[model samples]
Structures are given as structure tokens and as C-alpha cells.
Target: MKKHIVNLWAFIHLVAHRFATDGVAQTAASLTYTTLLAIVPLITISLTIFSAFPAFQTVSTNLKIFLLENMLPESAGKVISVYMFQFSENAGKLTAIGTVILAITAFLLMQTIEHALNGIWHVRRARPWTQRLLIYWAVLTLGPVLIGGSLYVTSYFTSLTLGLGHEVHGATLYGLKFTPILLTVTAMSLLYLMVPNRYVMARHAWLGGLVAGVCFELMKTLFSNYVSHLPSYTMVYGAFAILPLFLLWIYLSWMVLLLGAVITAMLPQYAQGAMAGEQRVGYQFDLAVRTLVQLSHAHLRGEVLSLVQLVKLTHIHGEMLEQVLISLQDGHWVLRTNQGWALARHPDKILLRELFERLVFDAHHAQLDLGVIVRQPDLNLSDWVRSSAQLKLGEPCR
Candidate 1:
């Protein structure tokens, strides 16, 4: 019981640390701004696509009604709906260049979203621009079509269910009512799974998505109720209440989306540390050296070491391991390949002093080069590290 309590606290601390370090507020604010800029163009493009299909001619109208009834609060929805439809109609009159610009604006929003998600996963690199453009373009083009199709299918089945009420029970009708919640969960799960550059376990993504979906639904209900009951917004903004209300909702939605991502990113740590009571690994020069040595040996043996393999062998936190690996790559002491990490040079040629200098001393150059003189206590820490590594690894110090 005590162990479980300690582990739970540790998990909580880890999450709090990540949230602060990741700058969730700043990221959410950026996304909200970008989303606002992109929303009109996105809606215009989606409406154009919908109009291309005879079957989806009514989709834009239905989607507006759905958003007003389920997503937006009070009079805000009606206000925004009028402007959105108006802009979408005007979008159809745009020239080719204007249409291209609209698509680019929407693409920028998706790019920002991907960048934020990748940052959460500690991914320093991104997919090639061409690949990214293709992917984002497909999503922008196909996503609305899929959504419209789903809504149409749901509405049809709902009508069918109501018509057959005399033959069947009300269970199907009740289930159909929850379609919005189900779709929200499914979309959130896919976002969690697909946005990050790294692999996200399905179970972890789904769990986080479910939490986010439920919270979003509850927030919508509570916020809508608050908006309906409160006259503060209407009294202050009067004719322009919708602007603030819409912006507020977009900001809140981004916050919820980021919270879900944070949860998914940290789920592995929570599972390992909380459930297993894993001992925390403190930063040590020896630990970093040991990790590289293992990788070096694996490279010489014609083997590759995955991140999970390194974690198990080193018994270190996954985040810490990633940090060490990133440092190693930055220092040009290691190279990351499609398979795994390998040595940039032969293991024998790699000196303990060089590795230590690259991984530790070089990284601290900014601090060391500060105007203040080094005190006696800080004398030649690199030399000491080199000597220690030589003694521990039983190799030449060089």
C-alpha cells in the first residue's frame, strides 16, 4: 500500500514536470491563434468539396446545424454560423491563386499541430517537407468528406431506427443519440495515435482519448449552460458577443486537446513507475558512459539496440535515455539509423576522455564560459571524469 502511494505521487510529479517544461499554455495559445486564422479557409474548402458531390449538397447546411445544436453555446453558434456560411459562399467566387492561398493557410494550421505534438514526444526531427505536404493535403481534402459521410449515415440510420420503433425496442434509438460522443472519442484517439512522430501504443492513445472525449463533452454541456444562464457576455459585448464566445471555446478546446496529448505521452512513465514502483535513475557520468559503451559494443557485434532494449539494459527512465541519446548524436559520437543507434567511429578509437568531453563538458561550454572565474571546487571536472571512466571501463584514458 505504501509503495503504491509513493508510486502514485511519483507519477503525479512526473506529469507536472512535463506539463511545465513542455509549455502547454504557450503551445495551446499558439494553436488557438493559428486555428482562428485557418478556420474560415478550412470551412470554405470543406464546403467546396462537399458541393462537388451531388449527394453531399446538403452536408454543409446539416453540418452547420449540428455544430450549432451540439458544439456551440447559446446565440454564439447562430452568429458564427451566419458568417461561416457567408464566407463559404464567397469562397466559391475566388480565383485559382486565392484558392491556393486558402489551402496553404489550412495546411499551416495542420503543420503547427504536428509540430506541437512532435515537441511533446521530444522529437527533434520532422518528416520531409514533401511527405508532410502530401499527407496534410490528403487530410485536408478527405477529412470533410469522411465526416460528412459519417453524419449522413448516422442520420439515415437514426431515421430508420425511429421508423421501426414499433417493431423494435428503444435501445437503438438511445445508442444513436450517443453517436456524437463515439465519433468524438474515435477522432481524438486517431489524433493521439497519428500526430506524434514516434510510435504510440493503441491502448495508451485510446485511454487518453476516452478521457479527453468525456471531458470535452462535459465541458461543452457545462459551458453552454453557463452561457445560457449568464448575461454578462451579452451585456458587455451586445452585438458582438459571438466573437469572444467563439474564441473562448476554441482556446478551451486546444487546452483539452493538449492535455490529452500530455496524458498519452506520459502514460508509459505512469505505467512503469506507478504500477511497478520502478526506482528512479539519477543523472551520473558513469551511467551515460555505460549506455554508450553498450551501444558501441552492439555496433561492433553487428547488432542494433532499440530504445526499449537500452531502457531495459540500463534500467533508466525512458526520457532520460532519450536525452542521453540526443546528446550523443549532437556530439557526433553516435549516429541514429533506421534500425537503431550505431557508433560514428570504431569503438576502440573512441576515447573515454573524448566521449566524456563531448557528452558533458562541451554541453556546459556556455555556463563554463560565463564571465565569472571558476572556483577551486570546480577545477578540471573533465579530467576527473576521464580518469573515472578509464578506471571503471578498464580501458586506456587517451
Candidate 2:
């Protein structure tokens, strides 16, 4: 029990630290603005898809109710739902070019979300625009249809069970009440798994999704209560209250979503760092040298070192390991492969002095600009750098 308590505290600390460092507030605010721009177009596109199916057409109102109820606080949900219904109705009057533009605008929202998720994972690479366009198009087109199908199936089952018997119907109703939570978790898991370029463990994705789903439900309940009791928005803005209230809710929703992402990205590091008793040691020359040597040995032996393997072997936090690996790749000292990292050149060609100069000394000098000012006449920086390299990389491999 004590150990579990310690682990929980450590997890919270790591998440708080990363949440601030990753600038989640800024990212969430940006997403909130983008979402507002795309919301109408996205809803129009989804409603269009729903209308294409005769079965879904009859129950579209129910679908809208479900979405609004689960997604927004009560009063805000009602306001947004009325506006969305009107907008979706008018969307059919648009020209071909306007429709195309509307679809692209909806895709922009997904693109922005992808960028934010990638930032959290420290992913520098991005899919090509052509690939992204196809992916995002499919999501925008098929996503609504799939959701409508699911809702249809659920409703069918509920009605069927009701006709059969009361006992079974009661159980079905109880299970259906949790549908919002299930859907939220499933969507969040997929987002975490697919948005970032890096591979996320399934367990981590599901755990993060579960946390986000629970928080979302709780927030909806709390916000609705607050809005109902507080009359502040209505008093201040009068008829215009819904607009600002909607914006505030969207901003808060994005903040919650990004917080879940932070938790997912940092979970591996927090778990391992706690066990290893790791702290912010920053970048040390010795640590870098050791990391390179390990990768070098694995490469020579035809062994692939995974991120988890490297973390365990080095007893280093995953984030720090990623940072070191990225720095090595940038300097052409290492190359990343599908399996893992490998040496860019033969170990023999990688001199200890040169490695240290590229990875450590250069980084330090860049930050401090030590070369910009004249040092004391007796001080010899080059000799000191070489000696430090030798001490860190004694008996160089190769």
C-alpha cells in the first residue's frame, strides 16, 4: 500500500511537470479556436452522411441528442444543438466548390489535433501531406457513418430486449446507460494510438483513455450544475450568453483532452523513472558516452535495442533517452531503423574525442557561447575538453 501511494505521487509529479513543459495550455487554447471554426462544417459533413442512410435518417434527432448530451454541459448542449440543426439544414444549399471547402475545413481540425499529439510525444517527423489528406478524408467521411451504425444497433437491441421481457430489458438499459463512457474511451484510445508518429503501448493508450473518459463525464455533470445554479452568464450576456458559454466549454474540453495526452506520453517515463529513482540530471557527457557505446555494441552484435530495452539498460527516463538519441541522430553519430538505433558508421571510425565534441562539448558551447569571450591566458579549453572526453570514454570500443 505504501509503495502504491509513492508511485501515485510520483506519477502525479511527472504529469504536472510535463504538462507545464509541453505548453499544454497554449496547445489547448489553439485547438479550442480551431474547433470553433470547424465545428459547423464537421457537423454538416457528419449529418450529410447520416442522411444518406434511410434507417439513420429516421433517427437522426436521437443521434443529435446523444451527441449533445454526452459532449457538452446541459444548457450549452441545447444551444449548440439548435444552431447545429439549422446549419446542417442550410448546408445542402451550398455549391460544389463550397462543399469541397467545407470538407477541407473540417479536415483542418483533425490536422491541428495531430500536430498537438505529435508535439507531446516529441515526434519531429510527420506524414506527407498527400498521405495525411487521404487519411483525414477517410476519417471525416466514414467516422460519422460508423457511429450512426453503432447507435442504430444499440437502439435496435434495446427495443428488441424490451419487447422480449422485463428482466432482460432492465439489464440492457443499465448497460446502455454506460454507452457514453464506453464510446468516449474507445475514441480517446484510438486517438492516442494513431495520432502520434511514435508507437504507443496499447495498455498506456487504454489507461489514458479511461482517465479522460471518466473526467469528461464528471466535468459534464459538474459544469451543468454550475451553469444551472450560477445565472452569471445569463445575467451578464443576456441573450448572448450561450456564445461565450459555448466557447468556454470548448476551451475546457480541449484542456481535458490534452491533459490525457500528456498523461499517456509521460506514463512510461514516470513508471520507469520512479523505479530507477531518476531525477533531472540534465545531459551529462558520461551518460551520452555510455548510451552511444551501448548502441554501438548492440549494432555490432546484430542486436536491435528497443526504446524500452535502452531505458532498462541505462536506468534512464524514456524522455531523456529520447532526447539523447535525437541529439545523436542530429549529429550523424547514430541512425534510427525500423527495429531500433544503429551506428551511422563503423565503431572503429567513431573516435571517442570526436563523439564527445559533437554530442557534449558542442551542445554546451552553443548554450553558453564560451568561445565568444576571451578566457584567462592560462586557461586551455581545448585541452580540458579532450581530457574530459578521455575520462568519460575510457578504452574506446573498436
Candidate 3:
């Protein structure tokens, strides 16, 4: 118990240090700034679109009040409000001219957002030009349309509920109580549908979105009613008061976005592989092992290795490790001898080892040097005729 506790503490400390490192801090700050900039444009772009349609303009106003006006810093709220006011005025005249310009700006903003978020998701932009065009169109054109429809549906429900409440209890409880929840659900669903790159399961997305949306709406309401009531920072920080508030709001918004992603990702795993199609093993051992075996077999045609050594050195479990070895042996990539396993000498195993070592090294040090740890004699192996699958980059075989 003591040993486990000590190890756990050490691990946690290491993680903290890793994140607290200058590079990590700088990266985090950069992402935060990028996200904040993206949010303003994204919100403005959406509002501009809704303002083009008279019926949807009212919905946009409600959304703005709910999301941005109520939650943002007073300065930011003022800036956005003024901009939207100008947009509303121009939107009332020469519909297509302003609309077209705003549409182009929104599309550009979406692409910018996509580029940033895609990096965070670790997904590559593999689609060609035509596909990119289609995807962008779907996000920019179809997105607002969907939101408009949802808002209309919500308004209808609100009216029906309010009418029923008045008739039954002589109070508007149902509409007042349920409207926020309905709005939250709508917002969450939109986020889930719009945010991710790879395909997300609908059920998980919906549940996550709903939960996050509800929490966000509640927080917005609470913040507006309580936080906004607090005295302005001018007395506290003087001229710099609004700065901290803006930063705080930015941080809070980022936290909300992260929480939404986490909840959505976790929902599929809530029941421990019940929802996911195939449960991959911890750390993706099977994948790593397959790659290891393939590289070894490709390079060392008759390299011999003890099963015990393979298991210990590769950190693979006994059964799965044996299966891999047996597979390689059966395939004639390796030969079983009395002493150890032997394989035909190919050059690829060395390349595989180098690749694996690089991965391990990167995992440990994300770029930090650990003194002589990587240069130690124990880990530094030279070449051998019988040393199958032992390859080193830029080092001659001994």
C-alpha cells in the first residue's frame, strides 16, 4: 500500500510538472487566445446569417442574450452588441449584398475554426477539394438553417406549454420551467453536430450535448443574476478590472468546451465497452505488438529470442506475447531453436526498433532531455549476427 501510494504521488507530481513546464504553459495560453478570437467571429457570423431572415432574427437575438450578452464580460458584450446592431441595420436593406459578404466572412471564419479544432482532435484533413467544399457548405449553410428550425420548434412548444399552464394552474410554470431546458438541449445538439471531425455516435453526442447544454444554460443564468450583480472591477482594479473579467470569461468558456468534449467522449465508454463496437485493449498493445512482430519478421528472417525475454523487454503480457511469437514462428519469419528463437536476418527489424524507441523516448520527454538516461550502456545495444530484430538508427551493426 505504501509503495503504491508513493508511486501514485510521484506520477501525479510528474504530470503536474509536465503541464507546468514553460512550453506547456505557452501552448495552453496560445490555444486560449486562438479560441477566444475564434469565438467572436463564429458568433458574429452566425448572428449575421440569422439577421438576414426576419423570422430567425428574433431567435438570434434570444440566443445572443442567452449565450453572449449574459455570459460575456461587459466590455465584450458591448462590443458584440454594437457590431450586431450595425449588422441589423444594414441587413434591413440590400439583403443579398451584405448577406453575400457576411456569408463569405463566415465561411472563412469556419475554415479558420476547423483548422484550429482539427489540430486539437489530432485528425488530418484527408478530403480533396470537392469534399472540402461540400463539408464547408454543410457547416456554414445547413448549420444555421438547422438552428433556425430548432428555435421555431422550441417557440411552438413554449407557446403550447404556456397556454396549457394558464388554462390549468392560472400560471405559466411549464413554459417558464421547460423553455430553458429546451433551449439548452437545442444548443448542445447543435454543438455536438458541429464540433467534431470524425464521426461521433448520435446517442453519445446527444446525451453529452444535452448535459453540457443544460449545465451551460444554468451557469449562464446564475452568472448573469449573481456575478453581474457584483460591483464593477473599476473600484477594485481601477482601469484593469475589465481585463481580468474578460480573461475569466474566456477561461470559463474554454472549460465548458472541454467539459462538453470529455462528456461526449466518455458517454460511449460509460458502460465499459457496451457502446463501442470493438473494445481495444489498454495502451493499444495489440497494435504495437503487431507492428513489432511484423518489423522483426521482415528484417530478421532467423533471429532467435527467448519468449521470456520478449515478454519482459516488450512489456507485453505472457499470453498475447506468446501468440505473437508463435504466429511469427509459424509463418517462418522466425525459427525456434533449443536455446532461443532465430530469424532470417533482414534489415527492417532494426528500423522497427528505432521507430519504437523513438516513440518511447517521445512519450517520456516530449522534448526534454533526461541527462544520461537515454545514453546509458544498458539500453545501448550494438549489432550482432544472431541479434535478430535489433536495429539502431545511424549505428553500424557489430
- Displacement of residue 248 (Cα, Å) in model 3 is 3.7
Ranking by TM-score: 2, 1, 3
What do the candidate models score in CA lDDT, each in turn? 0.75, 0.78, 0.52
- Would you list the rank order by lDDT, best first? 2, 1, 3
**Which candidate's TM-score is highest?**
2
Decide which is better by TM-score, 2 or 3: 2
Expressed as tens digits, the lDDT of each residue in 225-336 for candidate 1 is 8888886988899878778888888888887878788888888767755234333332445657878878877987988887767877776645557778887777677888
Stretches of candidate 3 exceeding 4 Å from the true structure: 1-83, 87-101, 124-126, 157-176, 193-195, 236-247, 266-398
Pairs of colliding residues, candidate 1: none
Error of 2 at 180 (Å): 1.0
Q: Which ten residues in a row have the lowest lDDT in candidate 1?
A: 367-376
lDDT of 3 by residue, 264-297 (tens): 5444333232222234322333434553564465
Q: How close is every model to the real structure, measured as TM-score?
A: 0.76, 0.78, 0.51
Worst 10 residues of 3 by lDDT: 269-278
Candidate 2 segments whose C-alpha is farther than 4 A from its true place:
52-55, 165-170, 274-321, 335-342, 351-398
Most lDDT-accurate candidate:
2
C-alpha lDDT (0 to 100) for residue 140 of candidate 3: 65
